[model samples]
Target: MRVKMRSKHRKAVKFYSTCFGFREPYKVLIDGTFVHHLITQRLLPADEALRDLLSASRVLGS
Candidate 1:
């Protein structure tokens, strides 16, 4: 299941990059709701989590 999800994420990133010119070191918007959910789910080190989810070289939050 995890592997499948990761593959899907990679595919999505590739598609976005190819068709939309989205570059690496992606910028992410972190809102209160997202922060709350992360805390509730105990997903610490938010930056790393976002980086992995986006297959980004680095994650820049706004």
Candidate 2:
């Protein structure tokens, strides 16, 4: 699944930058911290992360 980001968030910029294939640099200051945004070729299934978290929670009964 393709996730289109309409607006840039510093948190996301930092996160996405950490991923491989994402090297284009961008910046945002979040909570007084400077965050760098990088280009990324990685496309994650939007629901995959949530699904895993939910499944893990169910398994652990948390």
Candidate 3:
């Protein structure tokens, strides 16, 4: 299940990058709720997690 989800996400990223003009160092909008969840889930230092999830070299947060 996890692998499938990862594959799907990768495909989506590829599609967007190819069809559109999306590039690396993807920009992400972080909200309060997301921050709360991260803290509760012990996933602090959000940048690392987002980078891994997005398969990006870097992550620019807003």
Candidate 4:
């Protein structure tokens, strides 16, 4: 699934990915911290980190 981020939460995404042992570099810096892809085609769970991110970046009527 493709996820569109509302805001580029760079540090948070990187930190979370790192914590989860995501793909190498674990930190892709683009669009001011908007992670285009995560975990090399792996499915990300609906965890708190993602929830917080979504809540923070949630767009209206989305």
Best prediction by lDDT? 1
* Candidate 2 local lDDT, 1-62, one digit each (tens): 23333123434545665774444322222331211211132223423333332222222112
Error of 1 at 12 (Å): 1.1
Model 1 C-alpha lDDT per residue in residues 1-62, reported as the tens digit of each score: 28999999999999999999999778778889999988998888899878888877798766
Question: How do all the candidates rank in terms of lDDT, highest first?
Answer: 1, 3, 4, 2
| Cα lDDT tens digits for candidate 4, 1-62 | 12445345555567666797754322323342334343443424423345555443432221
Q: Arrange candidates by TM-score, descending.
A: 1, 3, 4, 2
Between candidates 3 and 4, name the one with more favorable lDDT: 3
What are the models' TM-scores?
0.81, 0.22, 0.74, 0.23
Q: Give the TM-score of candidate 1.
A: 0.81
lDDT of each: 0.86, 0.32, 0.81, 0.43
Pick out the ten consecutive residues of candidate 2 with the lowest summed lDDT.
Answer: 32-41
How well does candidate 2 match the true structure in TM-score terms? 0.22
For 20-59, candidate 3 gives per-residue lDDT tens digits of: 9899878778789989988998876889877766777888
* Pairs clashing within candidate 3: none
Please name the candidate that would achieve the greatest TM-score relative to the true structure. Answer: 1
The residue-level lDDT of candidate 1 at 29 comes to: 80
